[model samples]
Target: MKKKIIVAPLNWGLGHASRCVPIINALIKDNFTPIIASDGSSLEFLKQEFPYLETLHLPSYNIKYGKNLKKNLFLQLPTILRAIKEERKIIELFITKNSTVSGIISDNRFGVRSSIIPSIYITHQINILSGLTTFFTSRIHQNIIKKFDECWIPDNSNSEFSGKLSTSSRKLNQKFIGALSRFKREELEQSIAVLIILSGPEPNRTFLEEKLISAFKNDKRNVVFVLGKIEAVQKSWVINNCTFYNFLLSEELEHKINSSKVILCRSGYSSILDLAVLGKKVFFIPTKNQPEQEYLANYLEDTKLAPFSEVANFTSEKLKEVKFYKGLQVAKVEFDVALFSLFHSKRKL
Candidate 1:
């Protein structure tokens, strides 16, 4: 019988779940039965991708963000903590019910570790940027991370793709697992001038969608806007010269991205990795008040990978300044070695 490995991703946005595609593929290739656990759109997406694999509906933080960055996060604190507690209980219950479980791979879900089984945590943010909550939050975050047997960073260790975001000031035993992207490198003919991808929690997602539509409504260039609303019925319509889509599957999304001359999207790490893999010129619009997206946008600009603008200041001129960014040179050999090592070490089939 194949060893069962539980794969769980945080339900923040599609980014966390999207990055897990490659990891799940790797796990399956090694002859392990991968079980997915998530909730909301993330769960729906995984189920669509791997119809044959068993999936469980884990509790979600169900975080909602508003225009007021500080107030939104402050309001969600209690709920976030509750979700963490629930995640811990759910993990323990699942492990107890399944005696064949071999290991757990958690993608940014803090409480999804097991005491009896080996657990690995995956994240790109190790050192939270210095801010008002930096002193307290970073320490607490590190403590949670230390519980896992190993922490896997999805970026090159030597030439860090995340700048200071992934760099740890304190010593940490982490494997640089390379950039995990669902889209692979392929040559597709460009047909559209721009492809705008909207993601993250809302009203921010809705806010961005409206903003982008208003910004480019009159432009004659061929543009496509992906609403990123997976639950909505898939629909498409053309307004002026732009085409709008409710959502696209992995292959369809990849084709659309490759077919576009330029891309407009958030500065989320997963999106960044996908753009890096495609090596496309992009204009990044950071979500209002989200520090991680802000940091990533600035980092990309600093590294000459992409130019970013704040949502309030976004304009057509920003797109003109975008230059091609050579994507991160991931150490594939290192990633494969680390991944294979994990599968071979415990509960060998």
Candidate 2:
């Protein structure tokens, strides 16, 4: 009988769901039955993309951001625990229904994946994001990884092009998947210029879009704005040389990213992975109070893989830097080891 795998993705943001696209495709190619367990919004998206896959509703450990880190941490703890409990129950029930479930791969949903089957947890941050120094973050993260069958990081381990942001490692049973990006190069590259990918949970995404539109009103560069599907209600507006697309599918967005000279986007992992694989320069503006994005943006800036500007200070000068760093290129797909080997033995039912 064919192996059955279930992907339990966290619905905190679309990044979790988006990053799994390639993994799901790989599973489909390998002929593994891949079931998706996610919340309403993520399930809805997966339903559109893979209607054939079985899906179950799962709870999300949503974050509550405050102006300061301490306040945000305190506010979110309870919600996270509640979500973990809810997710545990859901996964237990799911495994009960699908006794053929061979393995579970979790994209940041710890509780659900831990509850059933041989579970693999995928997370770049192994330790808690806060209260940990750089010296011990990797060590702590590795300790956490011990709980799962395996852990996967979506980044290149090579130093030449990786920058500090994606080079972190956890030795045992941990794999680097070489930055899973939805964008793939197809046509010849063009230079119509700067493409800005606007995404993330709402209010912040809208806020950033408005800020960019305001700042670049008089700029003479070709700009493509992807407002995301959630923002479909937004009316299209042309400002100087910019063309705004309300929403873009993976293929269309890939074309825009390739055609553009530079990309301006939020510093989410999935977005960073896409830019990294394409070797495109990016001006990342991470969401406010979002520590993960902030860390990646800072790391990118420090390592010189990409440049970033705070939403408060995003300007034409920052936009100009994208052109200078266009020379840097990283080899894509350098590390794509098979995932099946991570387990002691493939459990076929």
Candidate 3:
């Protein structure tokens, strides 16, 4: 029997779920059965991505974000802690019920681990980007990360792709995975002038969609917009020169990315990894008031990797500057070796 590995990702957004696709595929290739666990849109996302796999529902952290995360996070801390504790119990029970399970991989889900099996924690943010509380938050997160047998930092060794986000100060059993992206780069024609991929938690997701639509609805360029609404019925319609989609699975979204000349998206780490894999130049508009996005946007710009703007400052005129910035053109798209190493020491519980 193939050793079963539980792959659990956070329910915050599709980024965590999406990045896990390549890892899940690698698991299957390495002859391991991957059981997915997640909640909310992320769960819906993986089900669509891998309909054949058995899935377990993990409770959502539901730490209300965006309406001021830095301010609201204080109010949600207790609930967040309780959620992590519950997640740990649920995973332990699952492992106990199925002694055949050999391992676990958690993508930022703090509690999805087991002492019985080899567990891996995957994250790019060694330096959690909370304003004022960054030092305290990073220390807390680092402690949780140390619980796993090994931690996987999904970036190059020097943390070139993620800047300071993945650079850990204290030593731990960490491996630098080249990069995690589901899409493969292909030699294709760039037919679309602009492709907008919007993601992250709600209110903000809807907010960006509305703002961009109002700004560019009249433009005659060949623009395509993906709403990132995984729950909504999949739909597409053309308005003026732009085509809008409710959501697109991996294959379809890859085609969209390869067909576009300039891509615009939130500077989420997963999105950055995907764009790097494709070796595409992009313009980013970080989600308003979100600290991580803001930090990534600035870091990418400061490093001359990509150009970004605040949501309010992003305009048709500002987009013209994207041509001047050099995206991660030098970053090699090599993911196999590091991914294969993920299974080097799998032990039966």
Candidate 4:
């Protein structure tokens, strides 16, 4: 019998859940039974995709940042540490109870996998955003990663794929897994439909949606907005040739993204991967006060693959001025040997 695998993703944002779609699809294609663990709207979205897979309600933590950077960090420090402890306990309990799980794959849930079992940590941000860290900080992050059997980063090896961000690291074991995208690449079609995905938590996501709606006030493109499978106030409105949807399913959503001319969305790692794999033209808008989004937005724009707009510069003029990549396909895609090598250890629990 094939070994069972559990795919656990951080619940703070839908990006973790969305990016895992490709991995889950690949696992299913390879005949591996994958049990998905998450909470909130992500759990509902997963259930919609794979209704038969086992599901677990895991706790999630989101670091809150206020307007004043210093005040936000001070307020969030205690809660952040407490959340880590809580997450660790939950992971330990799950492992103790589920003996059939042969492999554990995590998307940013720190220290959750079993010590004796084969586990892989998947993340794009190996470097913290504080930017004022000592060399010891990177070492500490590397040490935490060492606890896992493997580490996988979703990035292209080519210079055009990754821009400005330092891919350099002392850890030789890290692997570059070409972007795992949710959208499948398909033949080009002449269409005017546009799919806008709304993700992340709270005020920012909603705020971005409103900005997008306003930007399309006099535009000629069709638009549909997905509110990340959450239960929110719903309204149907049409502007010019655009239609907005609060949510959509796997096949329905994929169809829309495939047929669209341009994609306007967040610069989250998962979304970027999906766009890259599809070879679609994209416009990225990073959230305010979030350094990771800012980094991705800046990098994509600098690399010339996608244009980015910061929250402060979100306007119809900017969106209209953005250019999209039409004929670019990253041919050099490879999986991180460090990440999948854990399978060879024969470390069955």
Which candidate leads the pack in lDDT?
3
Greater-TM-score candidate between 1 and 2? 1
Writing each residue's lDDT as its tens digit, candidate 1 over 165-189 gives 7777665667777777888766788
Local error of candidate 2 at residue 174 (angstroms): 1.7
Candidate achieving higher TM-score, 3 or 4: 3
Instruction: For residues 127-203, write the lDDT of model 2, one tens digit per residue.
Output: 44554454565564566567787777676556333344334444557666666766665555677577877877656
Model 2: lDDT of residue 187 = 50
Weakest 10 consecutive residues of candidate 1 by summed lDDT = 326-335
CA deviation > 4 Å runs, candidate 4: 66-74, 134-139, 158-166, 232-241, 324-328, 331-349
Listed in order, each prediction's TM-score against the native is: 0.93, 0.85, 0.95, 0.86
Question: How accurate locally is residue 264 in candidate 4, as Cα lDDT from 0 to 100?
Answer: 76
Expressed as tens digits, the lDDT of each residue in 1-349 for candidate 3 is 7778899989876899999998899888878889999999999999999999989998888866766887788888888889889989999999889866888899999889988788899999888888778899989889988898888888888888777778876876888877788998887999999999999887788888888998888888999999899964689999999999999999999999988899999998899989988889899998778888888889889988889987877786677888788875545454563544544555554
Off by over 4 Å in 2: 114-116, 131-144, 158-172, 187-191, 231-240, 326-328, 334-337, 341-349
Best of the two (1, 4) by lDDT: 1
For model 3, the run of ten residues with the poorest summed lDDT: 334-343
Give the whole-model CA lDDT for all candidates, comma-separated.
0.82, 0.70, 0.85, 0.68
Looking at model 2, which ten-residue stretch has the lowest summed lDDT?
159-168
